[model samples]
Target: MPQGPNGYDLTVMHPFRGARYKDSVATNGRYWAGPLTHFAINTATYLFTYHFFANYSTEYPDGFLSEQTLKSFEGVSGERGSFKWKHGAERIPENWYRRQPGNDYGILNFALDAVGALQALPYMAVIGGNTGEPNTFTGVNIADLTGGVFNAATLLEGNNAMCFAFQAVHSAAPDILKGLLGNVVLAVSKLTDALDPILAQLGCPQMAKYDKSLLAKFPGAGAGL
Candidate 1:
């Protein structure tokens, strides 16, 4: 397999990789340099957004909910069912879920490049092999071309846990981000409800993708998002 029909490892980077701050921080240039730092962005994003919407709304008009109080609600929604859709391949149709927006909407699409980067690292050891097995990595590991290669030809791991967890903390991260955005929506929803008896306001309402009109409940007594 070659190109140039032509050049081998010429190392010429495309110009588009050098983009703006919000963009490049994920894909082309992201690195913790180590494990401890790999998903730092996710934790930070989760803490902040969770506080703003989840933590804030639960206690507002009264006080803030203790951090321990809210953990009781994580992923506890009662509605549950089995997913029966079976495609010949794992590919999902574009309309099936909320689509990702922007170039680096998640953690940027590193694609095969991420595997190449891992293979090149001389330190810390390689951990797995083909068929998801682990073996002693040899200097010849590159020739096998296996590590992260999903199809034995390419690696498509742009949405690793670290990447997804980071995106989940932001409103831009689709419905799951709602776990945090839910707070803000709840806050405004309650504010709208409490004020419905007398005052009419525009600022607090169904805005953006979240319908303020739909989130009319505050879970329990004396809580407002």
Candidate 2:
């Protein structure tokens, strides 16, 4: 089923048998196509997710929380819940959650490709089918195809792990920043409370208010007042 001098032979590339023939040029190429495509997709996702989280972490280390910690305060109480929503996803410019499905898919694909790549080598060895010669015009030799699959699997796993890690970090960034800001405001309020006595002795107006409403917003800000 080799092609004509100027055109591809459809019989050689038939959907059912294109990848089954040992000597056909399309065999090895088609056999490895699925894993290769998965590898490429995971690699691209890893790069994008890694850079996003890396840049974000570098730019805001103090405000970066782990996903677990972010979730801890998500629906705990009224103020914390409002804080999470108001200063977190609601205010952040980017849609971090939108990319989650892609990352999830990448992880699943990585698992499938890893298993496929591992099985491919053993399957080829057991099948005992001749991979033909090493001529460039025909197709790749068995050794080259096996090596390529191994390398692609290794890279795919590594990239998939990186993508998962970065995605977690990116997803929690907004909540972490919100918490940091809330703590800063709380600290400032406490400092103002500490200076109340000094202002009273100097006959100056006190800036710190122990009002119930304000204390409710910055809980523990009026502890000593």
Candidate 3:
């Protein structure tokens, strides 16, 4: 039987998949016990959690990726120097020391910037950047670039839909049971949205072509990668 108007079944959807992956580290400790193991496991776990959470964050309810103000720390070294309190004495002239930018060694920022660069490649190619013209580069073509765009856009749409749906249900739920039911709905919606492209590629006719009318209703639908 269907669980909602969308005919989605909630039983198979795993909304807590991120939490499960995080928990698995503790449950299966042997897998994360070697050198660089923590790095590998934590990377995978954080990726999943970030994907599931999408743009939602308790601290930043409006969105998570906002422009950060660059912080300056010009006098850090002199402030922490050993001889700063000597009366009438020139504070240690830490000429070799310099203030560091907050994002100077931000690993997360570097990774995010790299991903952003990769995502912009297709657009750059369209605007005459050297992504290799169609048939010019052996084994590389425009379809591959467009397909990547399509897949990325689909995934983004899925994430957005999941976040919007979750927020709607979460806001209206009056009690614990209703909240649980809302979560179930959210899980199903998220799974279905995410799998739509895969199912379409697998020859599901209904999933292959999106309805133009529906697209009119949802502007984000136009961003079909």
Candidate 4:
């Protein structure tokens, strides 16, 4: 049986069959490996499709802010206006418009719109109905798997935070000041490991044990993400 990221046996992913009699010849040889192989292949194909779409889509938009509004905020802050959230939906804040500046509001709006459009393209292509598109799969629309409708409020809040962080980093003093700030951030990251035991005690999700076998491969198989 194949082991998962946490060293647990993946019984469902790879089931074992009992020993066969020597006189009995298996008629369906493909049945043994076919399903698992196809599952892996299909999974790999979809994952690659998702990665390619995500990387290429974000590159074209430049900043989270669109081209039309980006020029307005170019010199206002030395920071790059086009920051993107890795987990876009989760990072968005609840209230954005009321607290952020006017220019920031525009930039946030542009970023949200661009992200929404770019994200939707892959979903549409993979599961969109018969709209005469080349890559669309008419069988079933799985766009909802991506997420629900875009929440402008949450997106704005997240973008505002992202832009603010970028601006703060850009505006920070050089030399000793920057070095101190870097050290603080590094310390915080290192200390985060200490919280794992506390979180586990509180019944929160605990970190998975590192698997050396997955050193150069994807580390999320059977992780139940």
If scored against the real structure, what TM-score would every candidate get? Answer: 0.17, 0.18, 0.16, 0.18
Residue 216, candidate 4: C-alpha displacement in angstroms: 3.2
lDDT tens digits by residue: candidate 4, 31-89: 21111122223223333222222211233321122221222322222334554433223
Model 3 misses residue 160 by how many Å? 16
lDDT of each: 0.26, 0.30, 0.28, 0.26
Query: Can you write out model 3's per-residue Cα lDDT over 1-225, one digit (the tens) per residue?
Result: 112221111121122333443354334422211101221233334333223222333443322321110001112223223412334443323222222333132333323432332233322111111112221211112223232333334422323222222222232233323445657666656655765554443332221222222112222212212
Q: Across residues 1-225, which tens digit of lDDT does each residue of candidate 2 receive?
A: 233221221221232232333343333322221222222333333333222332123343322332333333343224433544433332222322222323333434444443343344332211111123221222122223232222323423433322222322232334335556767556655554654443343332211211222212222112211
Q: What local lDDT score does residue 166 receive in model 1, on the 0 to 100 scale? A: 23
TM-score of 3: 0.16
Clashes of each: 6, 0, 0, 3
On lDDT, the stronger of 1 and 2 is 2
Once model 2 is optimally superposed onto the true structure by TM-score, how far is the C-alpha of residue 103 displaced, in angstroms? 23
Write down the RMSD of all candidates, one decimal each: 25.1, 28.7, 21.8, 22.4
Model 3 spans > 4 angstroms off: 1-102, 123-135, 138-225
lDDT of 1: 0.26
User: Candidate 1: minimum summed lDDT over ten consecutive residues — where?
Assistant: 216-225
Could you say which candidate leads in lDDT?
2
Clashing residue pairs for model 2: none
Cα misplacement distance, residue 3 of candidate 1 (Å): 22
